[model samples]
Each structure stands twice: as C-alpha cells, then as structure tokens.
Target: MNRPHYILQPVSPLFITLSLTGAFMLNLLPWGRWIGAPDFVALVLVFWGIHQPRKVGIGIAFFMGLMMDVHDSTLLGENALAYTMLSYLAIMIHRRVLWFPVMTQAVHVFPLLVFTQAIQVLVRFIVSGRFPGWLHFIESFVAIALWPAITWLLLAPQRRAVDRDHTRPI
Candidate 1:
C-alpha cells in the first residue's frame, strides 16, 4: 500500500494581489528620517517570485518596480531594472530556496536581498552622483531579519489542512 501524499490548496490570485497591495501600502507609510527602513515592496516581490514564480514573474516585478519608482518619485527605470534582475535571480534559485525550512531559507535569501539593494543604490548613484551611504545597505539586514516573520504572516492563511490525493479515485 502506498502512503498518502498530502497537498496544499491552490492559492487564489486574490490572495497574491492582496499581499502585494499590502506591501505597497506599507511602503507608502512614512518611516521618518531613519535611513534603514526595509523596502516592503521588494520584500513582497521576492517572496512571491520565490514561492510563485509562475504567477509572479519578471514582468510583474518590473511593473511593480515602475510603480515604486512613481511612488518614490525616482528615475523611471531605476527600480524596474533592479527588480527585473532581482526577480530573475529569485527564479533561478527558487528551487533551492524552497527546499529549505523557512529559517534556513532566510540565510540563503539574505544575499539576494543585499544584491538587489546594492543594484538600487548603484543605479541611484549613477543617476544623481549621490551616494546613499552605508545606512542604505542596513535595510537589507533589516529585511533579512524580517524574512521569517513575513513568510509566516503571508503563508499562515494558506497553510490549511493538507488534503490527501482525492484524484487517486475511490
């Protein structure tokens, strides 16, 4: 006799959209003069890109970057470029990342988050000749620290009773 295979329910598009929207709303909130506020939008994009690559690909990341650019009043393509590249990288490593438990995954994800933030900083420096300073990179650390919490929050709702294979027939 074969053991039962448990499967999670398919995630709805509504949930994904709401998660991204919530990230955007968080990004919109002013966090005062602190220079290390995490990039919430990028965090959400990375999360979805890693977990749901088929649903959130480079195009969506680029579009979200554009939205962020508009929101932050930055150069039009700056974030688009960074986000597209980040999504590409996330897709490349999604398989490996997914195999790890969430805590271990954060260790793997930390570098990717730093790389994306580095790209953003580089682009801004190139465009304006202004260095965003060391504090800017600190946000990546904050993002890394928040990874487990964010993953828990986003995945909590979807982590329902795992269903047995019903399609296997009566």
Candidate 2:
C-alpha cells in the first residue's frame, strides 16, 4: 500500500527559545488567585520536548525549570526536578503522541502533565511539609484543555507551506 507524503519544515532553535521565554513570561503574569491558570512554561517545555526532542531535551527543561524556580521564588530545585521528569517522559512518548490527532494527543498528554504536577507538588510538600490548595491540582486539567490550541500555535511556524503546483514532488 502507498502512503501519502508530507513536507517537513525545519525549526529554528532561536524560535524554540523565544517560545519558551514567552511561556515563562506568561507564567509570571499575575492571574490573581486563579486555581487553573495553567503552567505555561511547563506546557511549552513539554511541547518542544515532544516535537523537537533532539533540540529540546532534559537539559533545556532543567534550565527552564531553574528559571521558573527563581522567578516564582520557591524552592531552588523543585521546578527543575519536575521539568526534568516531564522532558524525559515527553521524549520517550514523543513519537507515539505526535502520530495522533490533536484532541487524541491531549488525552494522551494529560496523564504526563499530571505526573509532572504531582512531582512538583510532592517536592513542595517535602520542602514545606504541606500541600497546596486542592484547586491547584486543577491546573493540569486546564493545561490539558488548552493543549490543542497550544500545539497549533507553536507548530504554526514550523508547518510547511503547500505548493499548488502538483507536478513537483514534495
């Protein structure tokens, strides 16, 4: 059986870095006691990790997490540890996850996101001996809900522009 061909576009490292920076900035925004504000930085990290695993891997995630740690003024290594784990998981499942439609991908991603959040919370509890408000856990679901949109936005630049001239092979 024959398979359809697809045109793949190259992604820039600078673009990926900029995207991660934007997400970090979004996280720093004051959402004012919102329970499900969504962890923008983590979401972006996971996206890049899954789509561009070669370029965006555990080291990048760890650094991003450190920046988040400092930005949030929380424990030093908490976010770093969580992001490291998230990136590892993202890379491991990247191929399988990317093969699915966006909605289906989100369903696959929710558990991973939740796992990262659970790690973060576990670290926080270990450091401070207390759990955050129950609603804090809802943020992972919020991120899950926004996955399709986020994937579209981040992948938009990397999508190949189709050529109408059918004579040439892609």
Cα lDDT, all candidates: 0.85, 0.87
* Candidate 1 lDDT tens digits, 100-145: 7778888888888888888988988888899978888888888888
RMSD to native for every prediction? 4.4, 2.7
Compared to the true structure, candidate 1 yields what TM-score? Answer: 0.88
User: lDDT score of model 1?
Assistant: 0.85
- For model 2, residues 1-170, the per-residue Cα lDDT tens digits are 26554565788889998999899889888982488889998899889888999999999999999998898888998899999999999999999998888888898888888999899889888888999877888998999999989987888776656555668666
Off by over 4 Å in 2: 1-6, 162-170
Candidate 1 runs further than 4 Å off: 1-6, 162-170
Q: How many steric clashes does model 1 contain?
A: 0
Residue 42 lDDT (model 1): 85
How does candidate 2 score on lDDT? 0.87
Note the residue pairs that clash in candidate 1: none
